[model samples]
Target: MSMREVDPPRPSPARVYDYLLGGRHNSKVDRDAAERVMRLWPVRELALANRRFLIAAVRRLTREFGVRQFIDIGSGLPTEQNVHQVAAPDSRVLYVDNDALVVAEGGNLLDGRQAGYIEGDLRDPHRIITHPETSRLIDPTVPTALMIIGMMHYITDADDPAGIIRDLMVHLAPGSFLVVSTATDTLPDEMRQAIDMYYRNPAAPLVWRSRETVERFFDGLEPVSPGLTAVEKWTDSEAAAGPWLVIAGMARKP
Candidate 1:
């Protein structure tokens, strides 16, 4: 049998994203997948823009809202200025992802005192919220930031993405925050077709949602200033306006 058949390394969503962000911790399979998507879409820009938004949101929560702990679900490979790095020195961060490689690599980079990593799927909020590492790093009694950035597009409607957000939010105390970023259903037909074809894998299909549908993910929460907007526009007013393929929002539990 061919080596490909003997042991094929499937492209990991997190690793592909890492590659798109120009990180060095991606495999050939991941780089190949990211380059393929890059040809079809501006995924590199989307990834960088999304990371900038994430840093801004975390800084907002830490500096403005006085939030000291964070639970970042669907967190990808460890990169510069990660949530823990952006937050205060005393703040704690719990990173969760479905990819074992991501979890393992992230765990290795963490100091273990202020940050921790767990292998958990986004669809199973209870397991993630209740995991020992989550319990150890996060205090549910105090406000915490829950970030689900750049990964919601993979959670199709059938997965009830809104319901998952609600389930996770129920565990945090009042004044906690929810930060989300996802792909918008505003891609041109040619671009959309290209993306659709690239992400046709049964396990990691992309599912773009309308702006209204994406906003509904923040239902029952108090939206931060600027509300839901394009990823680049989230924190920078000077950033060019949309037709952006990705949008982001930050909200607080009342």
Candidate 2:
């Protein structure tokens, strides 16, 4: 009898993140990836902290800036307090990612009832910006909060992440906002190396940037108070000073 081929299920980085947030949508493959990151970054707190930043940023955008529309690119599995969940009571959100597992699992979790999900790459902003389905939720003429959390590193100078950001920002109105975060190297090099190695196992590895490199993503935007800073420090009443591998900030299109 011929043996059946067993193709490894290479779960998405998004699914791995879902595991870290205590969601059940992740596969064993994703679990392995999360474990690798938790071990390498040497600061398990970074993951938790990053989530907290997302919450705070969203709240401020909704309550303070009156942003009722969102396009959360690279949103992982539908973990508790997802962007639509947090912003939904009032805001309409459209999530975009190309991971099949993420679309399948998140579909099961959200049931496509609350906010819409589209399987597309953020690198392809033109399609996302102009897609008819997305147009239903996000009107380019209105203000929106574009959440690009923890996904920029996957894109490089060759991919033009900075340019991607600029194009998206130009389409938003003055009140529209952008909350972005990426891995940094303020922590020990060993920690960064280990954390990156986890993603390195896949077809492509993540490339962490320096603070200045990340700041470039917000070049033309009017920065919110506290400016671009560490993830745990962006607009925090009492910022925690630590050598973490993540940096974050919020800015307006002006």
Cα deviation at 53, candidate 1, in Å, is: 0.3
List model 1 lDDT by residue over 109-143, tens digit each.
78758898899999999999888888888889999
**Pairs clashing in candidate 1?**
none
lDDT of 2 by residue, 1-254 (tens): 11112113774667667677777666677788778777666444666778888888888888888888998998886576788777747578888888765765565566444478888888888988888768777777889999998777787678888899888888887878999988875667787676666566465567778888888898878899776777878646587655646888999987
Candidate 2: residue 51 Cα off by (Å) = 0.6
Each model's lDDT: 0.84, 0.76
**Superposed model 1: Cα runs more than 4 Å off:** 1-8
- RMSD per model, one decimal: 3.5, 4.0
In candidate 2, where is summed lDDT lowest over 10 consecutive residues?
1-10
| lDDT for model 2 | 0.76
For all predicted structures, in order, the TM-scores are: 0.91, 0.88
